[model samples]
Target chain A: MSEGKGGGETVELLLPATPERLALARTTGAAIASRWRFTYDEIADLRLAIDELCLTLIRPAQQEGEPRRLTLAYTLDGSSMVVRGQVDKPNPAAVNGDGQAPQPTSVSDLSERILDALVDEHGSERTDSQLSAWLRKGRSVAAP
Target chain B: MEEVFEIAEYSDDSTPVLSVRGEIDVSTAPELRDRLLGVAQDGYSTVVVDLSEVTFLDSTALGVLVSGLKRFRSAGGDLRLVVTGRNVTKVLEITGLVEVFPIFDSVSEAVST
Candidate 1:
């Protein structure tokens, strides 16, 4: 249908759960956000926020042994814009792309806490009858 | 879609408070490192990192804090952890970082000592 744009056009970008893909994610996300003419701050937020999306999906989804697919979909229009993220996992995802859920490494105390917190914040949870956890993790931005 | 990153409010005073929120990562770590260092460098003897609002953190980010803690302590300042939830504590305990930094129940307690 009509999403404020002229015709039927949707943008989709995919990135792996690796640090190497972070730059790409930010670049692509910002580009999409810019299409709607978002402000610099808005675009920056989208960049960092989308980075979290990858961390959430990658670490929690445990794609290390294999490869987890982080898919982002954004629809832009003259009036509004939308971004969506998706991943496959059960309870809080995994850590560092490893399907094996590892406790924090024995290093720094704050580091450990940070690792666990990242998991809960990024992991996908199945709702009553729908897969809505991933999308919920994404933050929206509006151009001005 | 809404953004997913968390931003912590950091304060550097006689008693520094690193108010953290959301998740911390390599991408957004400089902000945190600067805050932590700023307090420690300002000669604050007590640095309290409030993780009550911090829902998530990572190794690289944690390393940033660890180094900050060491630097703060080296400068005669002490870095204290304000535990917020079991999830974060679990990581600390599992990682055995609990032995390194002083852990407090709250920011008030962290600053008190």
Candidate 2:
């Protein structure tokens, strides 16, 4: 869990990068998004987005072998929340030497369309050692 | 963890209906795919997936449904969806799948059409 440097709240979770653990990730993200005053529709979008993002990391990590795990960080700042996820053991083939943000290879076209409609911003980052994906959503003004 | 997924199959006249409850993600999508395949193999010409009780579904589930639809359609059959929940309908809309699959508000409506 990474601590928030400012006054914003950040929650971090670590779970095995398996399909069975996806529900826990979605539930946790929904709880945090609810607390941050996101609308019902917004929460639903976040839940789906989190599921897609986690699965995007999990599928490749699962093929690589043991100790498959995912680290998720949810940071609530002002009217928006940012969720960042990284596989503990990244696929060797996915690591980049140029320190550029590499696209996640496992995201299906359906996942791409869903994320495009749900989140404000999303992308993946890969360095020499690790790969991560993140999404940010701003609370809808229609919420009371 | 307790079970958060369930799928039951039955018939409305000659058409088959798969009533699903709880979330459908990667973990539970295989079960769905299997059942859809089972229906197709059993020679059902039309099938309805009743997702009115479904609370959540991801792209994996969508892919499964799309595959099932393709299988049925290839054989001169069709796949229909019954989605009453806003979230589920919103997902179908987001992916523009609402235009792809025949969607209804209830099982009866889907089975009828």
Give candidates' CA RMSD values in order.
11.5, 2.8
Worst 10 residues of 1 chain A by lDDT: A129-138
User: Per candidate, chain B TM-score?
Assistant: 0.84, 0.95
Q: What is candidate 2's TM-score for chain B alone?
A: 0.95
What are the runs in model 2 whose C-alpha is more than 4 Å off? Answer: A1-3, A94-107, A141-144, B1-3
TM-score, every prediction: 0.47, 0.90
Evaluate model 1: give its lDDT: 0.57
State the DockQ, from 0 to 1, for candidate 2.
0.59
Question: What lDDT tens digits, residue by residue, belong to model 2 across residues A1-144?
Answer: 444655678999998889889999988999988877888888889999999888778766665655677899999866788899988647567445653323333337788888889999988777545668899899877435
Quantify all predictions' global Cα lDDT against the true fold. Answer: 0.57, 0.84
Docking class of 2: medium
Going through the candidates in order, their DockQ values are 0.10, 0.59
In the range B19-39, model 1's lDDT, one tens digit per residue, is: 777556665666788887676
